[model samples]
Structures are given as C-alpha cells and as structure tokens.
Target: MPAASPQPRRPRAGSRRDEAARLAVLHAADDLLVEHGFGALTVEAIARRAGVAKQTIYRWWPSKVEILLDTLIEDSDKRLPVPTERPTAESIRGYLGDFARFLTDDPAGKVLLALIAEAQHDPHTAKSFHTRYLGPRRDQERDMLARAIDAGEVSPRLGLDATIDALVGPIVYCALTGSSIPRDLADTLAEGLLRPRSN
Candidate 1:
C-alpha cells in the first residue's frame, strides 16, 4: 500500500491566525449589522467586508442568523450593565432611565429595532433574544422591584409579575414601534406600580 500519505501537517500557527481572523469577521458582521439591517446582511458580504475568506465564516457560525445574533449579543453586552446597585425606588428609576436612554439613543436604538424586527421572523433568534437579552433584563428589574417592596417603598401587592410587564412593555414597544416613551412615562410607570392599593 502506498505509504499513508504523509499526514497533512496542520499549521498550528495558521490555526491561531485563523482564530484571530474569525473574530475579525464577527466584528465586521457586527459593524455591518449596525450600519445595515439584519435582513440585508449576507455571509459573503460579511467575509468581504471583514477581509477574511468566506470559508472562515462558515467554519465558525452555522448561519448568517447565528452570526447576527452573536453580534447583537456581543454589542449589547458591552453597553448594558446588570444593575447591581442598592435596590431603592430612586435607584430603580435611575437604572430604568439609563436603560431607556440606551434604547432610544441614536444608533443604538436603530440597531435594537432591527434586532426586534428580525427576531419576529426567526424563532431561534427570538428565543435567544429573550433568554439572553430580554429575560435577564426583566429579571433584574423584577428583583429591584421586589427589593423596593420589601423596603416599604412600593405596594406589597403590586403584583411583581405584572409590575415587571408594565415597566418593560412600554419601553420595548416604543423602541420597536419607532415612537417615544414620553418624558414622564418611566416615573409614571413606577409610581403607578409602586403605589399601594387602598383597602
């Protein structure tokens, strides 16, 4: 038998270089996502834009949608904090306002809207968005609200679940709907949910 073809020499250095190149590709895809919408994004375009081989992209992400979701998460992760400050009503207001500003600010808002729209048509993206992005946010806010309730600053029966929905729903709706959340909405929402129902 012909001597087993010399086992292909795997270029370890090339593998390391490829890893760096793959990261660059993901970054390029992220930039494209922010500039163009996800619907318009293409793997070929991303590879070209990143100055990497198309095979490099396929070597990592299984699909353009996966790449897009990864990019969105990476980008958002850099901007959003988990709100670990002491849970007071004032803290809640401040945190929520910061979050709202993030969602409404110039380019960030547009990217968020695009992600939401894309999530509507892509179940996997939607699931990931909720589990990774929206779910944690809601959980954070809920914990803050619960703390406020414990501190006697909010209604004991404010219905934590509903309160969370009320607080987050408007902001998300406005962001996705291309509308404003109103200057007073955050305060008003907090007050409405925090005020105790009289017996």
Candidate 2:
C-alpha cells in the first residue's frame, strides 16, 4: 500500500494571526457602532469592514446584538477598573464618577446607547444584555455595597437590593436620557441612599 499523504498542519491555538484577526473584527464592530446605531448595524457590514467573511462573524457571535454586546464588554473592561480597597462612600463616589465619565466619552457612550435601544426592541438581545453586561455589573456593585454596610459607611437600614437600585438607577436614567449628571450630583446621590434615616 502507498504511504498516506502527510496531513496539513493545523493552526496553533494562540497564533498571532488569529489574535490580529479577532482584534480587527472587534475594532470594526466598534467603529460601526459609533457610525451607526445598533438598530442599523448588520453582520455583513461588520464582516466587510473587518475584511472577513460573514461566516467568520457568525462563527463567533450568534447575532449582531451579540457581537455588539461582546465588543462593548471587552472595550469597557479595559477602560473601567473596579476599586479593590475597602468600600467606603467616598470610594463608591469615585468609582461611579469614573464610570459615568467613561459612559459620556466618545464611542463608549454611543455603544451603550445602541445596546440599550436594541434591548428595548429585542427580547433575546435584552436577555443577553442582562446576562452578559447588566448582571455582572449589578453583582459587582452589590458586593461593594455589602462591604460598605460592613464597614459602617452605609446604613444597615438600607436594603441591599434597594441600595443597588439607588446607586445604579440614576446612572441608567441619565445614560438613557442622553443628559449629563453634574459631577457633584453622583456623590450626593450615593449619600442620599447611604445616610441613616432617623425613626
């Protein structure tokens, strides 16, 4: 019997080419998000911009919303750093202000608006947003609030869930409304929620 022909080598798992391709796709998606709202985004547009085929996008993301969601998560991950120190009211103010500034900055803010708009119209996108983005953020803030309560910086009288809403609700409101919340206002909002209520 003739010897079997040599098999073609497979690409390495962590090849530089693969990493560059992935980054290109993500960068394309990010740029499109800024140029057009999420509702206007298409997988074809992303693939074309990235210099890849539609199959390449679908192979990684199930839908356009998923692509945008992942892109937003990855981009935000680098820009925002959660505080590691003990959770005090001051720490909460500082962290939230930094996050708010991020949201207001170019590209990131636009992406956030697109995601929120998409979530309003599509249930699957909404679920993905909650699970992939909102859920993790909520959990992280909840832990920080818990630590603040333990530190006596926040009143134990405030319910954990309620406090979470209090900290996040205003931010969401401003983001969706496309309005600015004054710099001093974020600290005040935190104080209003954390301060002890006299019986």
Candidate 3:
C-alpha cells in the first residue's frame, strides 16, 4: 500500500517573513515544474531555488506536491472564479471564454495539467488532486448549474454532472491534446448547451 500522505504543517499567524517565504516556495515550485517537469521537482531543489531552508517549506506544506497544489489553488482562485450571482447565458459565456483562455494560456493551467498527469500514476496524488482541487471546482460548477436550472435558464434533462461534462469537456480536451482552442469556442459551447431543445 502507498504510504499515508504527510499532514501539512501550519505556520503561526502574523509573521511577514513567513508569508514571504510561503510565496517564495510557491513560486519556486511553479518555476521548477515548468522548467523541469514534475519528475524533477524535489523539496531540496525547491529550497535551493527559493533560497529558504527545506524545513521552512515543510513548516507550511507537507510535500512538493502540496506546494504545487498551493500554487494552483491560489492562481485558480484568481483566474477561474465562478461568479456568485444570478445566472445568465451571456455571463456564463464570458466565464467559459475566460476559462478556456486560462487553461490554454495561463501558467497555473500548466501546473494543473502537470498535477493531473502525475495523478494518473499515483493513487495518493489522485486522491489529493480531487480532494483539494478538482472536487471543489466541480462542486462550484454544479452549484452554478443548479442555479441555472432553478431559474429555468437551462434544461434539467441531464443531471448536474452530465451537464457540466457537456459544458466543460471540449475545452479540457483541447487543453490536454495541445489543440488550438478557438477564440469563440466558449461562445459556441455556451450557446449550444443553453439552446432549448425541440420537443
């Protein structure tokens, strides 16, 4: 059996140096992942790159994977936020477009893809990836779809997960395959999925 994942260490509050070190570690992890791929990422290498002791990183994160997860979560929160407002097809289209760009163009997206690829081979990483990242994002998407359904803006024929797959699958496929995502792919997806089906 794979060993249990390490528990994260929480740093004390109110230290500016602590916060700075945390940012440095996150940045260093991202840079290393982009430069050398996940296979080459290590706590020692990250410590050298960030100019901080390895123990400092361990004080805040459990492992190199967790450090990368931190970088992904921070960037995803900023770049892929689901708006906390009423549903509109136009607004959803905007979000879809932004999301497509984020996945295809953002460094954070690269990090996410790397983590996902690694997760395919590591059961522990798969669990952590879902629990910390994919699960929450999917939950947010489900909530938005639920709201849209309640508002009668979208049909309830397919359940939330299927609807989400319909909405997000193509963009993700393009990202994974290195295909060029069209500028209007989001508009097409949103309109197609939101269009009323003939009875």
Candidate 4:
C-alpha cells in the first residue's frame, strides 16, 4: 500500500507546487481506498490524509468516484500500451496483454475489483464508471473494429458490440476469477478474430 506524500498547504497556482498538491490528493485517495476500502473513505478523511482542505478536493472533483476514476486513468496510461501503429489485431493484442498484467498484483487491480462490485449494486456508480471510463474505451475499440471491417481484416457484417465483448470478455474473466492470464492468449485472440473462419 502506497502512502500519501505530505504536501504544502497553499501551493501557488499553475506551479509545480500546485501539481504536487493535486497528485497528493490523488495519492491520498488511492491510499485510503487501499487501506480502508471505499466504504470507509470520505472527502474529510481524504483531505486529512492528503494534508489539504476538503474544499480543495471539491473544487476539482465532484465525487470520490471521480477521484478514483482519475487515478485509474493515470494507471492505464502507465500500464496499457496499445501499439496503434501496428495493425488493429496487434494493437488489440497488445492491449489485452497489458490488461492481463494489471489484473495481477497491482493496486489498481483492487480498484478495478472494487469498482466492479460497486457497479453491480449501485446504479449511479455504474453510470459514472461507464460514462467516465468504460464507455470511452469500448467506443475506441469499436472504432478500431469498424476500421478493421473497412480494411477487410474483419468480416464486414461483424457486430462490433459482440466483437468487443469477445475480445474483452476473457480479460474480464481473469479480473473476476483472479486467475493469471496466459501470455499466448492475446495472440490466440488476435488470430481467432483476424483469421478466416470455417463453417
């Protein structure tokens, strides 16, 4: 579990000081989520943990979920390296390979599981997760599938929604089951998607 670094009380606007404070808040939130779980986390607690004001958190984010969403996005930038320069199949394979890595011992992996649990019973969290995170990624991949269709790499009639699920479903299964994803699964999936299917 990562501890939040202490930050200055009033950082100058647009300064490295200011950015440090912002990162402190994010780090504090992640630490709290890890140490206490989301149920025990609060804006007041986050402020105390970050050494900032509650208003400081509110000035930028509307809710704790938004804070977690930002932290998750940051984690994705560091972990998920999709090689878009490659063909769609390769990019998607790269993505799944990275996705599998995150599900394994990462702090963000706990966040993913917590968010999944929250989404099941909480409609608002589900909507926020979809709108702020999941939906955009799904749409991006859907666009990739559309391009693959145009290039005749995928069947023109393939339903992108199902195709996206087919590609992602295994990763989700790993996330849920806490199983280690095989290294070759990405290549297997890419081959299954791009290969000519025999009836």
How close is each model in CA RMSD to the real structure? 4.5, 3.5, 8.4, 9.8
* RMSD in angstroms between candidate 1 and the native structure over all alpha carbons: 4.5
Q: Which stretches of candidate 2 lie over 4 Å from their true place?
A: 1-17, 196-199
lDDT per residue (tens digit) for residues 79-127 in model 4: 6633445245556667777777776667786677678778899899999
- Model-by-model lDDT, in order? 0.71, 0.77, 0.83, 0.75
Return whichever of 1 and 3 wins on lDDT. Answer: 3
For candidate 2, give the lDDT of residue 15: 36
Question: How many clashes does each candidate structure show, in the order listed?
Answer: 0, 0, 0, 0
Query: Where does candidate 3 have its weakest 10-residue lDDT segment?
Result: 11-20
Which runs in model 4 stand beyond 4 Å of their true positions? 1-17, 81-83, 155-158, 196-199
lDDT of 1: 0.71
Determine which window of 10 residues in candidate 4 has minimal summed lDDT: 81-90
Best by TM-score: 3
lDDT of 2 by residue, 6-52 (tens): 99999665433366677788888889878876667788999999998
Off by over 4 Å in 1: 1-23, 106-108, 196-199
